[model samples]
Target: MIYFDNAATTKISENVLEEMMPYLKENYGNASSIYSLGQKSRAAIENSRIKIAEILKIKPSEIYFTSSGSESDNWAIKDILNKKEKNHIISSRIEHPAVLNSLKYVESKGIDVTLLSVDEFGNVNLDELKNSINDKTGLISIMFANNEIGTVEPVYEISKIARENNILFHTDAVQAIGNVKFNLKDLDVDMMSISGHKLGAPKGIGILYIKDGTEINSFIHGGSQERDRRASTENVASIVGIARAISDASENIDENIEYTKDLRDYFLEKLLNVDGIILNGPIENRLPGNINISLKGVKPQTMVRYLDMFDICVSQGSACAAGSIEPSYVLSAIGRSEELALSMIRISLNHNNTKEECDFVFDKILRGMKKFKK
Candidate 1:
């Protein structure tokens, strides 16, 4: 199958699974135990933490593991409000459901939330963000990159604004880790979230990076795991897999960017030449591998299912919310008509995708769109 729905999830690399094998088998000791075998598990978890921290140039103590990026987002956003006296929060309209729902929960409790609008290119209006900040604004939570359109945000500059105002800044970098090159050492953002599955690790593991001195209350209130920040027995195997995935993705980040970008450009070049196709997001400032388009008369679900018959997998934005009838909020936020939004499909690539796969998809797309027109 020519899988192109990477933004939804990825196949775990063989090396990552191999790294986790021992943990799943003989090394299946409790990470919290005092026995030598347990200590071995603990050591492995810490080592993974250190490796991931080093990749982002952050302290190991700052990286806290959670079940998923959604959990991490809930923890960071809610914890900031919990620890602060302010009742106001700021975020963009294009955030994932994790952030949007978390904000909604808080709003129900009387906290005011200001959602900044994005321009036609799916970029957050910076001036609106600056103007919305007041003494009561406790935090500004924005995504480092959009999941659907793959529009990279001005996180560094936004972090600077947050820093100047003494407000916490958090970014959901789940999709940005391997897609773009960024160093936490150079960025002044106070918090960020990442998921292992997005980087070729297995599911059920992710990291929440809270910079030193950033006040955050605990999310899960049970065990003292994750430095008392999160609770639950650690997934030892998945944690090991995360280390391998991070190392591999970080090392080849530059090469992957060039390869995926080339494939993406080639795919788009062929796709744009088709009749009655609308490109979504900023053509110039978009993600390296993300290509979102609207097939004017074709419903996204219908078209993707058609492609699925040909073993060409694609998506309609977040996999978490894929089956819903509602149009993509990311597209709607950027002022797309409902007809276009319902017809939009996200074609996301990865390092493993190839030019041949791109050509095959292009040919299938031409056929599919022609059939739809007929």
Candidate 2:
């Protein structure tokens, strides 16, 4: 299959799998134990933490591994709200469900939340963000890059504003981790969440970076792992795999960017020539790998199934919320009609995608559109 769903998850690289094998087999010791086997596992986890920290330009102590990006996001949001009463949060309308759902739960707890508006291009307004902060504003959670539309937010500026107001800033960087260059120290963000599966690592492992000395309550309670921030035995194998993926991806990010951009641009150019197609998100300032297109008079689900017949894999929206026919709240938030939102299909690329694959997808989609039209 020609997979075009890199935004949802990437195939695990062979190198990462090789790096993880020893831990998954012979070195399968509990990191919390004091025996030599346990020490070996513990040392591996620490080494992975250091590797991830080095990639983000932060101290190793600042990184906390979690089960997934959703878990990390929930921890960051709830931890801050639990620290005090009368909490308020500010987030954009286009964030992943992980952040949005976590905020919804926080709101259910009587905490005030302002779902910030985005412009037509799916970018948060810095002025609105500045206006949203107040004495009770405990946290500001925004995504670094949109998963569906691929619009990159002004995170550095937003974090700076949060710093000026002494409000904690957290970004769900699951989509941005491998696609963009991130420096935790330079961004000044208090917390950031990243998932391994979004890169080339295995699933069920993620990282949450909390800036040094940031006070937040723990969501899990039991063993004293992750420096008392999270209480769970470490997934030693996945941690090592995640580190290897990050290191490998970072080493050649520029090359990947060029390749994916070329593929996206070529595909979009072909699709734009088709009749009654509308492109979503900013034309320029968007993720290099993302191409979200809305076809008139066609359901996205129908198009996805049609493409699947040709062994072309894409997505109608976020994989987390897939199989739900609900009109995407994200597209609606950007002022798209329910029909337009229903017609939206997202095609994301990666380094493994090729020009030939793009050409094949274009031909199949064009033929599929013609068939539907007839």
Candidate 3:
């Protein structure tokens, strides 16, 4: 199958899998134990943490592991709210459900939440963000890049705003880890969340970066894992997998970005030849592999299934919200009409895809559109 829905999740790298095999086999001792076998597992976990820390230019103590990006996001937002020091938070309307839902839950508990509006490009208005802060605003959570539309946010500016106001800043960088390059020290955000599955690692591992001395309550309570902050047995194999995967992605990011962007532009040029196809998000600052578009008078689910029949995998919206027959909230936040929102399809790419695959998928899409002509 020619998979175009890489934004949902990517295949695990073969090298990453090979590196993880030992941990899954003879090296299966618990990381929390004190025996030699356990020490081996502990050593692997710490080494992986150090590797990831070096990539982000942060302290190894600052990185905490969780099961997924959703978990990391929930921990960052909920734990801060649990601190009870702030009753107000700010976020964008186009954030992934992980952040949006967490904020919604807190809002139900009488916390004031200001979901800033985005422009037509799904970018948060920095002015609105600046105007929303008050003494009670203790934290600002925004995504580094959008999953559905792929618009990269002004995170450096956002970080500066939060610092100036003494408000904590957290970014869900699940989609930006491999697509956009940034060092944590330069960006200077208090917290950032990353998912291994979005890049080349396995699906059961994620990381949350909390800057040194940043105080937040712990949601998980158990054994002394993750410096006694996140309590659970470590998934040693996946941890090792993610460290290697991220290191490889970081080392070759420039080459990957050029290749994917060029291929995506070529595909868009061919696909937009058809009439009444409206592209979503900004053309210049979007992710290298993201292409979202709307076709009038057609249903996105129908098109998705049609492509799947030809072994071409695509998506209607975020996989987290799949199987819900609703217009995309991200599209709505960006001022798209209900009809256009319901008709949107996302075609995310990766370096593994080729021109021949794009040509095949474009031909199938042309036929599908012709079959459902308005």
Report clashes for each candidate as comma-separated counts.
0, 0, 0
lDDT of 1 by residue, 26-110 (tens): 9999999999989989999999999988998989999898888999899888865574468799999999999999999988877
Report lDDT (CA) for all predictions. 0.90, 0.90, 0.93
lDDT of 2 by residue, 1-374 (tens): 99999999999999999999999999999999999999999999999989988887899999999999999999999875665753999999899999888888888888899999999889999998988888999899999999999999999999889889988899999999889876887888999999999989999999888898888878899989998879988899999999999999899899998888888898889899999789988888888899988887887888899999988999998898888888888898888888888888899999999989999999988877777742
Score candidate 2 by TM-score against the native: 0.98
Error of 2 at 80 (Å): 3.2
TM-score of 1: 0.98
Order the candidates by lDDT, highest first.
3, 1, 2
TM-score of each: 0.98, 0.98, 0.99
- Comparing 1 and 3 by lDDT, which wins? 3
Q: After superposition, how far is residue 280 of candidate 3 from its true place, in Å?
A: 0.7
| RMSD vs true structure, all candidates | 1.0, 1.1, 0.8
